[model samples]
Target chain A: MALVLQTVDLQKRFGGIVATNDVSLSIEKGARHALIGPNGAGKTTVINLLTGVLRPTGGRILLEGEDITDLEAHKRVHLGIARTFQINQLFPDLTPLETIGLAVSERLGMGGQWWRLVGSKSAVVEQAVEVLDRFHLADVMHERTATLPYGKQRLVEIALAIACRPNVLLLDEPAAGVPEAERHDILAAVAALPKDVTVLLIEHDMDLVFSFADRISVLVNGELFVEGAPEDVARDPRVKAVYLGEEADA
Target chain B: MMAAEESGDASRTLVAQANAALAARARWSPLEIAFWLAAAASIFLFPTKHLILTEIAILGLFALSLDLLLGYAGIVSLGHAAFFGFGAYAAGLLAKYHVVNEPVLALLASGIATMLLGFVTSFLVLRGSDLTRLMVTLGVALVLREIANRLEITGGADGLQGIVMDPILGRFSFDIYGHVAYVYSLIMLFALFLVARRIVNSPFGLSLRSLKGNPLRAAAIGIHVNGRLVAIYTIAAGYAGIAGALLTQTTQFASLSVLDFERSADVLLILIIGGTGYLYGGLIGAVLFKLMQDWLANLTPQYWQFWIGLILVIIVLVGRDRITRTTDPIRALVQRATDRVWSGVRGSG
Candidate 1:
């Protein structure tokens, strides 16, 4: 299998504390890869490093063979890499329609045009509508995003990423804070994404993770602790011990 | 399965309605049209008030420039008068030296010149928090004022002198009755207003609002945050410069006071009093501000400003959220009507 994203000994440190250790990770093309770790395993930190939100202290990130370690966050997005925040970073005052339209327009290279209204471009609006429909956000398409239910807000976050048509989409806790009723929609929407675009999900929900991921990479203290098929990882004694130990500690 | 199919169809209908509704909202409404109509009528309707009306027009344009930066982009600038003063001086020197004889051309030249200054200085304001930005912008204005005060060409504290504006379009001479000046200012205001309207409603403007709401998220969606900021700041500077040029072209003079602190403060006040975000806020604010100043001066010449300051405090204390809550329904109603009408047309077509 071809690797779509690979990191060679990526490292980050805050003073003396290591946030992301010398952890080399790879995501194969068309792979539904899930990155799982307990609290403070640096899962979010890894996502941030990959997306250029935080500069890595050492090593390199390769996206389809190109070194992207030095790229800016926005530039990284343009280079076929997109991400959703763990805490749902969104434009509160903007409607879901406008939000998706902006993402579509930005990708279509109309973001810089001050002379053209958002509705002036049929392609942008149509693509935006399609994104809203796919994520089941059409019902609340015109409402202020801040006023949305947490579940819908999470859905909008992922919809925005999908609108960019990225080659690799990183979802950080897509089901986090979503209601029990809305959880099914989020998981189904994620599973129904197009096959060509690889997904790397950072999640805490084992049910969703085991159900969705073909490959599971468990992280522990900013390092890769285990990697295998979901069933293999699930049955592995070491992986089971890690969780049981954490349970005992808690 | 049937329920799912029905919901899918419902989603399609909603999205389709959204497409039509979006187009309708972007179109000009009757209230906006009436507002402009009244602005145009004022020149003829209040012929004797042309002088004050001219000032209102200039002030309105200046406030519009600020609205782009503060309201749309969320870039708080305490020294926006820098461009206005620079434009005023540029036009004054052009007219004084007979370098550019035509007023409109000279206005364009002044605007372009100040745009260059704004572009260069844009970087200074780019890498900062709000407090840092405030200091840097204020510093730029103060430095410009000092330079204008020191320069021989600017006539030092006396300001640039001997400015002569030829008739607009080479025919209409500026009259003492403030006839041509008011017409010229009004026309300039409307022309720029339309351009600003187009910009704020555009995709780029949407991106700007996104930046204002969340810069980190805007960047995540592939928006170059700093790049967007620099672009808006430069455009706003050009607009302010054009407004300044209008003042120089009409009054036939430019002075040190044009670049002073009060100019910046007053424009900020105008924007705050009227509200921001929408382009009309600046124009409406200018009218209210200028009229209030006029009437208040007539009634309480010594303490007019005291009352103005008190009104601003009252507005702030009473809160913008409370104010908008009361008026939002009217806006929502209009938007809903526009959508219905637009969908009706689309359905027929």
Candidate 2:
């Protein structure tokens, strides 16, 4: 499979401390890739660099063979790259349906047409309803996003990113705040997405990472420790010592 | 299924009507549109009302200019009067000394001068938070006022007088009765409103709205947040300048009153009363404010300001947003009935 996004020799530093050091990684088109590390291992920094939220000290970001190192975050979004935050970034005053409508409107380049508002567009409204329904959010579609339960909020954020119809989707700790009961539903929704969309997930739950990731990359102290298929990486003693503890293995 | 479908159809019809009504209200109600049109119509019909209406028109345009930045772009300024005063003084000085023979050219010069001033002041606005921004803008206006006071050529504390606007288009004389002046001011105000409305509905305006709603989100989405704000500020300043020039052209005078804190406060109060983010809000506020002033002064000339302040406080206490909230259901019913009647007329046609 052709690679869709690849980072070459990425480096970032804060004062004297290096956050990401020469981290080279590639995400194959349509592959489900997971990046995992202990807290402060700079997994989020990698996501930030790729999404143009933060500039790297040194590195190149290649999207579909074109280097997009200096691109702004919004331009990257327009170029078919979208990322959900570790914390939800939703329009709190807007309903779930309204939030989705804004995203879809932006994706379709109709955001500028105030006279052609989102509520007036039947097709866009129906599509927003379908997206909310996919995550069992139809009941609360008209409810403010801030009023939804935490798990549902997380689901809505994911739904918003997906609604962009992006070729590549980035999810940062999508299940971090989710409850045990809803985790299955969340996983099923993620798994059921169209096969053409590539995903880069940052997840801490070992069972989730192992089951969902087509390939796993382990980061340690701002460096890549190892990357391989989930089973082989699970077997690696270094990964277990650093990422998967004895309790996790048991 | 039949009952559910019937209700769905009913609600859809209700919603479509509500949507249309809301759109109309958002554009300002038909009554307001008719009122302005009627007022414009009367400028020709009633010669006596022309001068007062022209002042109203100029002030309304000034208030609208402030609303463009304050209401839509979310840039609060306590010193917009700086641009107004500058434009008034520019056009007044030009006309007094016969530097410009053409009134339109003088008006144009006044606007361009104020835009240059705005371009310089925009950098100050870019670096400050909202509170800081307010103070800085106020400081800029105060400084400009002081400079005007120091310069004898600008009439200093006495204010510039005897501003003889050259014949508009080299034809209509600005008489003491203000017939030509009123027409000139109305035409200018209408043009500014059209331009303001067009800009507010444009792509740039949408970006400004997005920036207002969430700056961080706007930045993430690739909007140059600061750049958009500075550009909007400059445009609003240009409008303010034109409003100032119109005032001088109508009054045959330019005064320190244009730069006073009361002018800014009055505009702010008008925006609050009429509504914000809606184009008509500023114009409506101006008419309501000036008419109330006239009526109150007639009743209690000494305590008119006190009564106006009380009205403003009541408006703020009631929650401005709640006061302006759409009562869509009732309006929607009437709108649908009207729609049917219109379609019937079209059918006959």
Candidate 3:
């Protein structure tokens, strides 16, 4: 499979503490890859590094064989790396339609057109509406996005990433804080994503990880402890021991 | 997904509805037109009060500039008067030297001059906390005020005097009654108001609102956050400069007081009174603020400021949102009545 995103010996240090150790990862194009780790396993940090939110102290990042380590965060997005936050980082005042419209306009390179009205371009509105409809956000699209239920807000987050038309989509805990009833809708939406777009799902839910990922990379203490198919990783004793031991400690 | 034929029909309906909603919002409502008409009528209705009306128009434009930064982009500056003073000085120098003595061209040049200042100082505001931005902006204004105070050409502490504005369009000399000044300032205010309205309603303006909502998310979604802020800041600077030029042109003088802290504070207070976000806030606030200031000063010349402070405290205690909410029903009622009257006229026609 063609590789889309790769990190080489990535490291991040805060004062004396190591947040991300000498870690390397590769995400294959069109692969449903899940990055699973415990609460402090540096999963979110990895997402931040890939999206250029946090610069790696030591290491290089590559996108489609390009050295994107030094690229700006928004430029990384322009180069087709889009991410959702672990916690929803959304415009509280913007409606879902506007939120999605902004992404679509930015993607279309019409973001700097100060003279054009918001709905002057029908293509943006069409795509924004399409993405909202796809994520089942059409009914409540007119309301402020923050007022929506957590599940729908999460869906809006995903829809924002999708509207950017990214080559590699990073979903940081798409189901986090979602009600159980609304979570299956998220799963359905996640599963129905376009086949060509590569997805890197950072999730704590084993059900989501197992059911969705074709390839699973288990992280333990900022290190890649296991990498294999879902079944193989599921069968691995180390992965089970870490979870069961943590469960026992709890 | 629904079947091909059905989904296409549904999506089409959706698209049309969205377009209609957006178009309606972007359309010029009758109320907005009526507001401008009323503003225009004030010139004729209170012809003897043109001097104060001119001041109100200038103050409104200045307030609009601040709203562009604070309301849309969430960049608050306590030193916005820097641009105003820069423009004031630029205009005074231009007119005093007879370099581009025509008022409109000089006004544009003054705007460009302030835009340069804004562009340079915008970088300083980009990296700091709000407090840092505030101090930096205030410092800029203070520094300029000091520079103007020390300069020979600017007339130092006594202010630039003997500046002459050319009769607008080679005719209509600025009469002593201030008719020309009020009309000229009002026209500029109206023109600039249209531009600001268009900008705040545009895609770029949407990006600006996003910046205020969440800068991090704005960047994550491919918005160059700093770039957007700088652009808006620079534009607002240009607007403030034009407003400053109006003060210079109408008064035929530029003073060190143009860059004073109170000017910045007064514009901020005007925005608070008018509300922000909506473009009309500045204009409405300017009217209320100038009128209140006029009335209070007449009532108690020695302590009008104290009363203004009390009024602001009352406004804050009652809450801006609650005030708007209380007026919502009245606004809706007017909107409905206007809509019916408009439809009736169209139907009869």
Query: B151 in model 3: Cα distance from truth in Å?
Result: 1.4
Q: Best candidate, TM-score-wise?
A: 3
Candidate 3 residue pairs in clash (backbone atoms < 3 Å): none
lDDT of 3 by residue, B1-349 (tens): 5599899998888888777566555667777999999999998899999999999999999999999999999899899899998999999999999998889899999999999989998999998789998899999999999999898999998999999889888886898899999999999999999999899889999999997999899999999999998999999999999999999999999999999999998898889899988888888999999899889999999999999999999998998999999999988887777667766777999
Per-prediction TM-score to the true structure, in the order listed: 0.95, 0.76, 0.97
Q: What is the C-alpha RMSD of each candidate to the true structure, in Å?
A: 2.5, 5.8, 1.9
True contacts kept of each: 0.81, 0.16, 0.83
Per-residue CA lDDT of model 2 for A111-208, tens digit only, reads 55533433566655666666776787766776777789888888887888878777888889888888988877778888998898899999988889
- Give candidate 3's error at residue A178 in angstroms: 2.1
The runs of at least 3 residues in candidate 2 whose Cα sits more than 4 Å from the true structure, single-residue gaps closed, are A1-30, A37-45, A55-71, A78-80, A91-168, A174-198, A204-208, A219-226, A236-250, B1-29, B41-49, B93-109, B150-155, B295-304, B325-349
List residue ranges in candidate 1 displaced over 4 A: A236-238, B1-15, B333-349
Looking only at chain B, model 1 earns a TM-score of 0.93
DockQ of each: 0.71, 0.23, 0.86
TM-score of chain B of 2: 0.86
**Which regions of candidate 3 deviate over 4 angstroms?**
B1-3, B334-349
Q: Write the per-residue lDDT of candidate 1 for residues B61-116, one digit (tens) a residue.
A: 99999999999999988899999999999999999999998888999999999999
Report the C-alpha lDDT of model 1 over A104-211, residue by residue, as the tens digit.
Answer: 899988998999776788788778988898888887888999999888899999899988888899999988888888888877877888897899999988988998
